[model samples]
Target chain A: MDILDLAFMQRALLAALLVGVTAPAIGTYLVQRRQALMGDGLGHVALTGVGLGFLLNESPVWMATAVCIAGAVVMELIRWYGRTRGDIALAMLFYGGMAGGVMLMNLSDSGSSANLSSYLFGSIATVSEEDLVAICILAAFVILTTVGLRRQLFAICQDEEFARVTGLPVRMLNLLVAVTAAVTVTVAMRVVGLLLVSALMVIPVAASQQIARSFKATFALAVGIGVTVTVSGTATSYYADVPSGATIVLFAIGLFVVLTALATPLAKRRAGRTAAAEECTLEAPGERTAADDVRV
Target chain B: MEQPVIALRGGVASLGGRPVLRGVDLAVRPGEVVALLGANGSGKSTAVRSIVGQVPLTGGELELFGTPQRRFRDWARVGYVPQRTTAAGGVPATVREVVSSGRLARTRFGMMRRADKEAVIRALELVGMADRLGDPVDALSGGQHQRVLIARALAGEPELLIMDEPMAGVDLASQEVLAEALRAQVARGATVLLVLHELGPLEPLIDRAVVLRDGCVVHDGPPPEAVGQHALPGHDHVHPHAGPAAEPIRTGLLT
Candidate 1:
């Protein structure tokens, strides 16, 4: 309660809430599209953007957003042209981004690495007013694009080839997803850092899929789970000494494990009941008599 | 004669430097049900894919509803059902929601009007899965899942329906259900092109069959009666001989 009164803590909490909602909202599509690792890939690319910002004395969040967007476009192009799996291109970008960021950070003045460390591990203590503003703007953009494209996104995620055959602009929609994901990773980097940002994107959705029966329900539930983890994890981190990013991601993983453990058996039981009901209906006298008559 | 609903001539496509469709020609007239039959890797899927612009033709001419393939933007006139795979990409979408997506081309800016909803419900009814509208697609049996996919295509009310292996992996009961659904569509004057490994329940509805061998059209004529039996699993060696061995049939007798 005391932490909520502090200005920095308030900003940190707000940032957590925003990222929490936007991350999983975007993650729902990525997870459904089987591109869960794309968040991690963009996060790594964001680090280089952060390093570029440090070297140029610009806003790191904006710089990171720009770099990540470019990285995302390049990654998509690779997927479009490359013969191998899209993950191969993502793996290349993932390592390349981290390595590029570290080298760029090393190339900067001696004191900059300490500043970059805040981004690497995430420090609620460092969320500035400008960073908060950036998160709000980018988060709004991500949310709007995702909501507006919900139908098309769902169609493509269900089956890309089928979506194409139906004449949806599959390629443009895919690029939109990539760019939105890039922005989400950049905005979330301040709350959960580059290393753990993807967990915020993927973990909640993974948990939601275990129980939610509809896409809308799964998306809403994932957002709820994400928000809960980010807010509670931020609060716990403030009271304890651990980094907020790691704490949030760890909390998410714990939630996923618990939800999966609980939902699997319940789902199996429901399936068993449905099967039994179907068998009973099939053996009803009217149907059995018709079958017997046909045989005779 | 009215122009064919779908026309692909000299279609040549290569994937990963390997030719998948080599000089393939296929044409389906309005209200006709033509099946594309082939062995695995014989390019049956690719031919259908090419018509819908999924596969780029290296050297070919394609037309849909009399418009050049390059200029064919009237998606509402066409419906496509891809082969059913085991995974629905892990997206937890209810049957109604999945079927509603087929109406995307008809909806402006992706906004579903009242008519779209009615069409979706009607499609579900046609597939005999109306009761399972709220259930997740993942919960359905393979047959039921296939039926839901067919309903998705039907919701569009497309004049030309192209399906790739709709019967593959489906049980007989579901196949019969799908056959009845297709029959209804054909009755309403819908033209159909299908890729099938064998003509089972769909055989009765098929007006003609085009068989592909190694990416080339080997036979295009009345549905091979012998293929109905040869198409059975474990009966791979029974090849149908329709004409002189020296010449490939370029046109179907039914046409």
Candidate 2:
């Protein structure tokens, strides 16, 4: 089989592109909201949703999507009920969901025969045309919602009470964010598997934040980083004969560390330059016009 | 003279199974900047949270713009600013994008109109933040962040703005700017209520003070009378100066 055959590489490339775009689009918000952990949680939730489908002899993707949506809604409801302590609620739901799944899998005799380990760690070789189509659809949905609600999500993530006070339907926006996460988790389940999808959600953003000057740049850079990691990890796995998901995560971690190191020196120099400029200039700090900040 | 924009009677609020606010009764009319004063854990934040529906009323009746709390449509007229600015520190959004969020209650899901842009721009200008409208919030100073938050609240065109510790971490210069902007907000016929630990800087900026202790309203009146009520013992009313003549503190905006 020619490694460069147009169709074979095209399918993999399409999968990588869809995963690259959707994960970071949703991951940017998740990382900012301190719910990066939710990505890990929902990944597990999708696993259970997938497991349930396997036990019942149903289409795993359909079952997983349905379960992921249900899990997202439950997470939202739990958060609403426990408003003041959001982290506690998230932990409870994530752990409880996983426990329920483990028990269900243990009790079902059929679950043992399904080779569910691959689902936990993921197996990209199983990427079917149907799964690819689903990823494409999910990618569109994530992009559209993110772009459409960009301002609202930005404000709410920064300060929900502030956003709520301004009458932004904080709860509905929260649900939208969670649903976006669920969709991303479902799409990612095929590539990174349940346990590791969160790395895809968090590492790229962390790396981008180290170097990007503004929110727009950070998100764009994060998405770019995501795609780069996926492509490099895929290439490395083929060459080295290692697990692709683990390779991808290791590559992302390397990117984050290198970026952080480079960013520190650059940020220090910029600060020094700005501080010197401030002494010579009379313009009040924070008085720069919106245009100036935007340009940065 | 007009109906109170917010009214709570015997309202109670609990957090993490602990009662933070108990039997609290308070009300505010439009254009009034009411200061909430209390020692730590006196339920000041809880009382404010109840008004915005962030904290549910465990008991008693709560109303907004004369409608029952449950019937109060979000963003219809109420606005809130929590103590923590809560902006995502790393997202790549500009100040304009954040201010435009104030219209979330109004815009639904779609492109913003010229009117929305105008409102956002006006909000930025009001807070002395118009120049930084394009700046990313993460790069801002603490004072600038606070002003951006105020800009966010103003973008909603809210009839009532509820701010929690709005001045806590703000620098003196930014405080003056925020105070001037708040005065303008009151002048524009909006109701303002805020929680503050110290009344020195904010004394002159507000119309009245609602003092809270142990989750209940100890006094609600002009700054003078409220100060008097604090001295009538059975409650701990220790001011920074116990001296008999610490000139009647003007509440709201330090300078």
Candidate 3:
């Protein structure tokens, strides 16, 4: 209750909640497309935007959004033309953006590694009044896209070719996915930090899929787990004095482990139930194959 | 002469700098079941995919339902079942979910109404996969996966159905079920174009067979007589009294 009194703490918790919801919401589609690490690429590129913001004396969040959207579109284009070598290209983009960010930060007016570290590792101080407003706006966009077009997104992600013939505006929808993913990356940058944001995007969905039978269930369960870990991680960081971003990411990984362990027993139980009710039997034809049924 | 449902003229396609479809011609009239047959690397799949706009045509004229492909926007009239690749994606999805996506053609803005849900179930029932609706797609056997894919195509109830290797890797029992389902689709005035390596049970249903060899149409007419291996497209009949190079390039044309 006392920690809630602090303005920065309030902003930080609110931002964490938004990150928890939006990360896995958009992440479900990315995972379905098997582009689970796309958020990682966007997050790395956003570092360049943050650095540019510092050099230009502007808001890093907005700049990161613009830059990430551009990077995501470029990545999508590379995917179209360079299918075999897209990974190598993405690797170049990632490292180049990261190195450029470091170089640009050194040239900025506040040329200090400490200033950049706050954004890289996620400090509570980064969620200023203005940053919170920007996060809210960006998160709103992410939520709307992910939820509003869930079926369309699911169709495209599940089977791009099938969706194309279904007349799904497949090309435009693909670009939209890239754009939405970029928005989500920047939305999470303040709370989860650029380095650790992908974990929140990927791990929660991974954990949920272990038990979820359908894409819809996987999505709902992943968002549930995301909200659980992020909120608790923020509270732990507040009382125990730790980095909020790392704490939240570690919390998600821990949940994934627990769910993975639980998946085995749950799977065994379901398998047993289905096995007991099995209708089709391996009865070889014309040889009284069922004779062994009673004998065995 | 009725306007063909699918009209491809001098269709040319390439993969990795190699011309897979070099000046190929194919057409399917309304309510006709046409099977494109060929051996591996014969460009049969490429030709079918090109008509569906899945493959890039290097040079060709493609018309779907009397409209040029570039301007054709009536996709609800077309259903495509792509050649299944073992590309189980990053997350699990139920069989029903996958089939429901096929009904996206009939929906507005991807919203599934009551009629759409019924259509999905009806499609599954047509393929005898209604029972597995709740099961995860990855948990199914290969033959069952094929049935689900066919069901997905059937869900849209398209005027023209394009399938690639719907029977590949499928069990004989599943094949019979698929054959029966295709029969029903034809009975209802649906046109079909499929790519198959062997005619098998589908031989009786095919109104015509267009065989491709080295990216060219080598045969086009009534379904070939499936007299053992003789009916197989690109089946090489080794002659007893011949030189060491006894296996000649014998497509369905020579048969």
Candidate 4:
């Protein structure tokens, strides 16, 4: 509670809270679509934007958002039109973005490798008011898109063909998902760092699914776990003098391990119930009780 | 004269530049139960998929309910069940949730209204899946999972229902249940189109059978006289077409 007195600590906590809510919100859809690593890819693409920001003496956060959105749209296009070995194309895009970022950062007047290192590892003390403002706006977009259109997203992720038959703008909805996921990546960049951003997005969802039996439960529980880890991780970093990004991601991984262990007993109990239900289904069709002979 | 509920004229589709449907023509009248049959890779699935707009036609034209496929926007009038796929592979979802997605066609912003909820439950009951509404789809057996998928399609309550490989991987009991459900839908005058490997329990309900070989319509007439498995003309490696063409009798590519 005493850490609340520090101005920088307050900013980091707010950023952490937003990151917690937005990451898994969009991440649930990505995981459902079996593209859990898309966030990591976007993070790499965003580095180019961050470097461009330094080169132009503009806000790196906004630059990263623009670059990430562009990369995500391109990725979606690749998924649509690329005929062979699409993953190799994605690998090229990711590495190209990373290399381009390093080159651009070196070309900038004020930017150095040390400055880029902060973006890679997430320095809480460096989160400016402008970055916080950008995070809040980006987080809002991620939350609204992920929650307001959950059913549409769920239908698309569950079965894309059926979704198209239902007259959903499947292509448009897919593009929206990519864009929203891009925004979420940038929102977490200031808190978790681009390198570790995907962990926060995927780990909490992974942890929640261990116990959650339904999409609704998985979504709510994952978001709950995300908030818990991010807030605590931020607080711990303040006291223990560790890197906030690593602390947060490690905390989430630990939670995943704990929840996985807890799910074992729950799964056994569920299996027992399922076995009892199957007993009824396994009854011989012609084997009848006295009711068969009795006239109604 | 009644307009056909579905019409595809000389439909041509190529998946990955390899032609799947080559000059295929198909039509389904109102309240008709049509079965599309073919051997492995016979383009039966592709033909049905093209009707539902999942597979785009590279040549020719498609129309749904008398409107061209390009302009058909009334999707609530149609229900579609794709080939068997795990309903919840990466993310856990319950039976009710999966069924409710079918009802979303009637929704405006994905909000589940009370009527929508009732329709989902009713669809589940149609497939005898109401008992497993709260259970996760991952817990269901293969046959039961197929029933859930059927229930999902039925939830839309469409006038036209399209199903691909609904009987694949299903047990005998579940097959009977599906046949009975299709019977009820036919009784209510709903149109149906399905892709089947064999007639099986559904033989009695099929009003017409359209057989395809190498993406061309080989047979379109009354239910074949064969009642037992492998008694159908297309079941063997080499079968006679009775002089439709003066060329040699074609053999199944797979055989």
Top-scoring candidate (lDDT): 4
Give the lowest summed-lDDT range of ten residues in model 4 chain B. Answer: B246-255
Which ranges in model 2 have alpha carbons more than 4 Å from their true place? A1-6, A82-117, A235-242, A280-296, B14-22, B74-76, B85-94, B134-138, B198-205, B225-255
Ranking by TM-score: 3, 4, 1, 2
Q: Which numbered prediction scores highest in TM-score against the true structure? A: 3
Those runs of model 1 whose alpha carbons end farther than 4 Å from true positions after fitting are: A85-89, A275-296, B85-88, B227-255
Model 4 CAPRI quality: acceptable
TM-score of every candidate: 0.89, 0.81, 0.92, 0.91
CA RMSD of each candidate after superposition: 6.3, 7.3, 6.2, 6.6
Q: Taking the candidates in order, what DockQ does each have?
A: 0.36, 0.31, 0.37, 0.37
- lDDT score, residue A109, model 1? 68
Question: Which is the better candidate, 1 or 4, if ranked by lDDT?
Answer: 4
lDDT (Cα, tens digit) per residue for candidate 1, span A51-159: 8887787888999999999999998898788856766777888889998888888777642767778888788778999999999999999999888889999888777
Provide the lDDT at A236 for model 1.
92
Comparing chain B with the reference, what is the TM-score for each candidate?
0.87, 0.84, 0.88, 0.88
lDDT of 2 by residue, B55-173 (tens): 88899998888889887775647666677655354455678766777766767573588888898898889889899877766677667777887787788788888888887656556
User: What TM-score does chain A reach in every model?
Assistant: 0.91, 0.86, 0.93, 0.93
- Candidate models: Cα lDDT each: 0.85, 0.76, 0.86, 0.88
User: What DockQ class does candidate 3 belong to?
Assistant: acceptable
Global fold similarity of model 1 (TM-score): 0.89
lDDT of 3 by residue, B1-255 (tens): 999999999999999899999999899999999999887899999998888888889998999999999889999999888885324357888888999999988998889999999999999999899999998887887777888888888999999999998877665677888999999999999999999867877889999999999999999999766676565675544323334533422111111
